[model samples]
Target chain A: MDGFWIILSGTLIAISCGLLGAYLVLRKMAMVGDAISHAVLPGIVLAYLFSGSRETIPMLIGAAVLGVLTTVLIELFYKQARLQIDASIGITFTWLFAIGIILISVFAGQVDLDQDCVLYGEIAYVPLDLWFTASGINLGPRTVWIAATLLLLILTFIYFGRRGLFITTFNEEYAKALGLNVAFWHYALMGSVSLTTVVSFESVGAILVVAFLIVPPATAYLITTSLKPMLWLTAFFGFLSSLGGYFLAVWINGSIAGAMATVAGIFFLCVWIFSLIKQKQASIPFRA
Target chain B: MNDKTAIEAHNLTVSYNRRPVLWNVDFELPAGQVIGIIGPNGSGKTTLLKAIMDLVKKSSGYVKLFEQDLEEVRERISYVPQRESVDWDFPASVMDVVLMGRYRKNKLLKRLSKADRDLAAEALEKVNMLEYSNRQISQLSGGQQQRVFIARSLAQGADLYIMDEPFVGVDAATEEAIMLLMQEMKKEGKTVVVVHHDLQTAKLYFDWIVLLNTRLVASGPKDQIFNEALLQEAYGGKLNVLSKVGELIKEKDFPVREK
Candidate 1:
């Protein structure tokens, strides 16, 4: 039962990451997600300092806001200073993340954060945090509910605003010309991505969070060209990777987050090999 | 609508990093005219279009459509940017591309209506691409892709259409189809402004010509302005000798003026 809850929660987190990751991949903002994932540490630390608690809600909110701010700052630098995007992302996130590292070292004794746990979470123990009602109805870990609710919100937004999101991602200028508030849509999408990243941070950790956000969708992109199909495939790939990685972790006595990321990498490799084989086969001559 | 100028640019100047690209360009296209804006590379032809559309910020000046500011009158004007400006591999079909044109009319949070779908189909039909409506945009040929973009503009259903090098990378048949479509739009009393590169087709297609070389060299009826002197001026004064010879004949009060 505990293992079932762990897999379920991990699957929910993966789905949330996949849902927001599709737009990030389409916008070519995958690296920005990586940067934000790293850069949110300081916000998390600061939220802990201010609140004097390790509650998930405040830390997630703080981290999400900082992530959005980081994205905006990157855009401002790109637009106003004419800086290259990669350079901007590297400069902004590295500085913020370094500051986070400094803060964590300075306040090491007081805060519950450790460098190892921030980078790779203890996913094996997540199910141990599950709570039950008076009737012993298991409610699962809090991360599961948070991830599920975030996934639902993301799916609802995508379902209703699919056309707007499609146009905005495909050609922002055309969307603006068509009188769509493209800037609003951009920020909204980025905010959703940041929110998902921060909320899933505890379950997946910061470093492996990027693999969850980028790899599944990227694998889906390799297999399909349509957005809707790619999204469905990405969710499926994410779920499969989570399940496979959980079992692989149990088999190898490895970190669940690391195992999940390894499984995603393996899935990408399989797709790459399949595509190469298909291409090679297409080039061969056939005897009648 | 037929009598008023569809587009009017007044003293428009655009620059990049203090280097002027378009200089004090003033022009107007009367409604229902198929006008060609002709200029050499780096002669501010595309810059003029971008400035008019407010895509690129102008250093100084204003553009008006039907006597209203460009932003306020945006819905009445449709712009088809250069084919190279967009990623062809973007995950959208031809029909999806066309439906983007109707986004302005649809309310926020509202899905595309059945009428919008029919309009998209009809626009694709006008470009002879109704069959390719469901195909991914990257699967289309270069000419077919240009037609799809033209269909997107057509779906906008605006009074004025501004196209930037719609003929680039297109086959001759596609060019002729686009020209015929422009003529049809003219007959329907819609103004079509095209940024043309081919000099040979300039005289064959456009009824009105605006010769630009970082400025408005001349703008008027094609027959009146499509002459050696204007072409020389627009081609960066290479034909200045011919103009000088005509000037000498006028000074000598000679007849015929060198044909």
Candidate 2:
């Protein structure tokens, strides 16, 4: 049962991140997602200092504000300074992350936040945090409820904004000419990424979050040629990785989040190699 | 001609990186005509179309469609950017791309109705690509891809169509199909503005011409604008290569002299 809670939590994070990551990967903004995960550190630190606790709401608000700022700054450098997008992403995230580290050290006397907790979270401790009602109702682990709610929110966002996201993702200029508000969809996506990062951060940490944000979608992308199948495949792969990651962690006596990321990486490699083999087989007839 | 004007630009000046690309371009295209905006490389032909569609921020100028602001008549206009502008490797099928043409009509959060799908299918049939509707877009040939774009815009059912380099790399059949479609649209009292490069086909395909060399050298009926002097003024020394190859004729007597 404890293992069930942990896997469910990991799977929920996987599904949410994989769905959003599909669009990010297709937009060539996977690195942007990575940049946001790291840059939201300052927001997390600030939220902790202001709220005096690690409550989800204030931390989400903080992360959202900083996430939007990070995207805007990246765009500013890419457009105003004419810097390449990768360079812009690199420069912005590192600067914010450095500031976050500085804040942590300076407030070391007051804040109990440690860098290790923020960077590589321990998922095994998920069962320890349980949510209860005033009437003595036990709602299982709080992380389960949070992950489920986040998944529902992501589903609603994707469902309502499907066309807007699709058209803009496939072709922004065409969508803009048709009078669709491109900026709104762009910021909406960034905000959702920010919120998801912060939610997953406590259990999976930034490292595994980044892995879920990129690896599953990339793995799904290898076999599929359409968005619908790609999304379904991404979710399936996410669930599989979560399930496999737990037992692997137990067998090796390692970190569960690290094992999950490693399993996701292994899935990606297997898919890539299989695709190469298939491509070679298809060309054999042509060569003959 | 006593016809209504479809597109009117006044005092249009566009600059990139502080250098003027299109300066003081003034042209009024009459309704129901095939108009070609012709220019050499770096003459801002694409820039002019972008300005009309309001895709790029204008340094200075305004473009009116049917004597009204673009905002007032957005649904009446369809813009097909350069075929190379988007990634064909994007994970969408032929039917999916064409369905995007139906997007402007449906309100946000509303699924496309059955009528929209029918219109999309009808548009694909018009482009002779109905059979490929389920195929992934990446599997398409260059011509098939161009046809898909045209089919998408056709589904828009707009009064005005603006295209950038629609014929640059399409097969001859696709080119002919697009030409026929343009002619059909003209017969329906629709206006088309294309950024064209082929001078030989320009005279055959367009009724009106707007020649540019960073400025409006000429804009009028093709018979008036396709003359040697206007073309020489627009192409500048770029015609030297064409004359040296002597593909057509009259190299020695024209502006093809080495300079």
Candidate 1 lDDT, A180-235, residue by residue in tens: 78778888888887887777777767656788789999999887767888889999
lDDT of 1 by residue, B66-146 (tens): 888767778888989888778788767888889888886357578778998899899999999999878988788778989
Q: Model 1 in CAPRI terms: which quality? A: acceptable
Give stretches of model 2 more than 4 Å off.
A52-57, A284-288, B1-3, B242-259
Interface RMSD of 1: 1.9
Q: What is the DockQ of the complex in model 2?
A: 0.63
* Per-residue error (Å), model 1, residue A239: 1.1
TM-score of 1: 0.90
Please give the lDDT score at residue A94 for candidate 2: 99
Interface RMSD over true interface Cα atoms for each candidate: 1.9, 1.3
| Per-model CA lDDT versus the true structure | 0.83, 0.88
Best candidate per DockQ, number? 2
lDDT string for model 2 (B1-259, tens) is 2339999999999888889988988888899999999987779999998899898878898898889998988988999988888889888899999999999734967988999999999999999999999999988987899999989998999999999998877788999999998999999999999998789899999999999888999999999987788888998776877654663453233333311
TM-score of each: 0.90, 0.94
Give lDDT: candidate 1, residue A131: 66
lDDT of 2 by residue, A104-189 (tens): 99999988887676544678888998889999798899888989999999989988898888899999999999988988898898
Interface RMSD of 2: 1.3
